[model samples]
Target: MATDVRVHLVDDNTPFRDSTAWLLETAGFEVHAYPSGPAFLAEWPSRRRGDGAECVVSDIRMPEMSGLQLQDTLRRQGCNVPLVFVTAHGDVPLAVEAMRKGASNFLEKPFSDDALLDSIRNAVAGARARGDGAVDSEVLAKLSPRERQVLDLVVASKPNKVIADILGISIKTVELHRANMMAKLGVRSLPELMKVALGHG
Candidate 1:
C-alpha cells in the first residue's frame, strides 16, 4: 500500500462517506469525501493536486448522476484516475460494466474496512504502473509489423493455434513471434503484454 495515497470517496450517504473517510485517514491515507458526482467535479481542480489522487471510491447508484455515468464523464475528459465502485449486491451487472469501462475494482456494500483498503491499494498500484512509461510508442515500434499483429492477438487472449490460423502462420511461428514480442517489450506475463498493447500499464 502507498503511504501517501489520496482518495476521493463519493456517495450521497453522509454517514457512509464520513465513516469511510475517517477509516482511510486512520489507515494513513489522505481522503476527501463528496456528497455527489457534481460536487466532486466542481471541486476536482482543487482536489487534484501535484501528485494526483491515487483512486476514487464511488457508489454505483445515486440520484441525478450514477457512478457509471461519472466514470464515463471522467473518461471523456481524459482523467485516468483508477475508479473503484461501491455497490449493492444486486448491482453486479453495473459493476461488470464499470470494469469493462476500465474500473479498477468494485466492492459490494456491507464490505469490511480491510476489503476497501485492499481494493484501493490495488487501484493505486495499477495507476502507478500505467503512468510508468514502460510501454511507449518507441518500445512498440521495435516489433515488426507481423510481430505487432501477433502481439495484438496474444494480448487479446488468443491461443497459439488461433493466432496461427488468424495470421496464416504455423503454430511454432506464432510462438516464436510471441516470444520475440515479449522479449522486445520486456514483458513476461500475459497481463503485462495486454497492458502494453492497450496503452494502459
Candidate 2:
C-alpha cells in the first residue's frame, strides 16, 4: 500500500499485461504496462525519476528482446531499477539467468495474485536496501579532491560548462570527472549522483 511503490510491467502478451496491471492497480500499486521490451526501453528514460522505479515485472520471452536482454540493457544504461521476472513453467532456466543478472525474484506463470504481490514487496524492500547501501559505499566516501569538487558542482545544479568554468578546467575534463564519480558511486544518472552527493538517498 505504499504510495512510493511504482511497478513497470513489461510483457508482449497484451492480455497478460492488462490483467497483471489491473491486479497490481487494485492492490494499490502505480503500474505502467509495456507491450514489448523495445516499447519499455523507448519510454524508460523519460519515465525515470530521481528515485527510479520501485520494481520491474517482466516476462522472459518476448519479441524484439527477451527479459534478460531488457535487464542487461537497463544495467548497461546505468539504470539499477529492481527487476522481477515472470516466466512460464518451462522458462525456469531463463528466470535463473535473469536472477544472475540482478533480478530480485521470479514468479512462474499461473501464480496467484497473493504470490505476485508478495514477490513484489520483497523485491521493493531489497532494492531500497541495496540503494541505501550503495549510497554509503567507500567508493562514494573516497572521492578525490577534483572528483569532490566536480560532485559539489553537480549537486549545486550547475551545468558542465558552468562547472568547468568555475573549476578552471576544460568541459571535457569536468565531464570525465563526473563520469568517474558516477562509476564509483554506481549511479547512472545525474539525479541519482546528485542524490548521493546531497546525502538524500
Candidate 3:
C-alpha cells in the first residue's frame, strides 16, 4: 500500500540534506528537507497533535539547535515523531544518550543509504504500531529499571543465564524480571515479547 509516510529531514548541510531527501524519496517516502532544526520547528505546528509526522532524520550537530536539543524540544511540545539521529562526529556516548532519550536510532555519517532506509522503515513501522507514544509510555511505566534491562537483553536473544551474567544478577532474578516484563506486556511467548520490547503494540 502507498502510505503517507512523510519523513521530516533536517540538516545544516544543504548538499547532504538534498541528497538524503532524494534517497528517501527514491525509496518511496515523502520527505520534507529543512536547513536546520530551527527551520523545521518554525514550520511545524506549535499545537501539533496525533501521529501525523511519520518520522524524522536529523543531523546531530547544528548551530541553531542540536539534534539532541531538537528531540528534547519535540518531546516537550508533544510532537512524538520518531527520531533518527545522523552525525558525522558520532561517538558511543552520543549514541547512547540519544537512545536513552527515546530516539528511534542513531546513525553515523557516511552510513549506507540502505541502512538509512532500513532505519526509516523501522521507525515508521514502530510509530504506526506505537500510535502517538502514550500506549508505549504506559506499558513501559509498568517495568522497573531492572526489568527494562532484562527486557532489552531478552530482545537481544540472550538466554536467562547470559542475561543474569550481563546484569550481575542471579539467574532467578533474571527469570523474575523476564517473567514480569512478559506479564506486564501481556505477551506469553518470546516473539510476542520481542515485539512488545521493540515498541510494537
Point out the higher-scoring one by TM-score: 1 or 2. Answer: 1
**Candidates in order: C-alpha RMSD to true structure:** 7.4, 13.8, 5.4
Error of 1 at 82 (Å): 0.5
Among all candidates shown, the one with the greatest lDDT:
1
TM-score of 1: 0.67
Question: What's each prediction's TM-score?
Answer: 0.67, 0.65, 0.69
Give the better candidate number (2 or 3) by TM-score. 3
Tens digits of lDDT, candidate 3, 1-201 = 114688889999999989888888888887788998888998777423355447888888888888889999989987778788886753535654666677777777788998788777767655665564534777899999988777755653447865665667899988888888888889999878756765554
lDDT of 2 by residue, 169-190 (tens): 8999999998888888879998
How would you order the candidates by lDDT, starting with the best?
Answer: 1, 2, 3
lDDT of each: 0.80, 0.77, 0.75
* Deviating ranges (above 4 Å) for candidate 3: 46-49, 89-91, 132-144, 147-201
In model 2, which runs have C-alpha deviations exceeding 4 angstroms? 134-201
The TM-score, computed over Cα atoms with residue i paired to residue i, of candidate 2 is 0.65
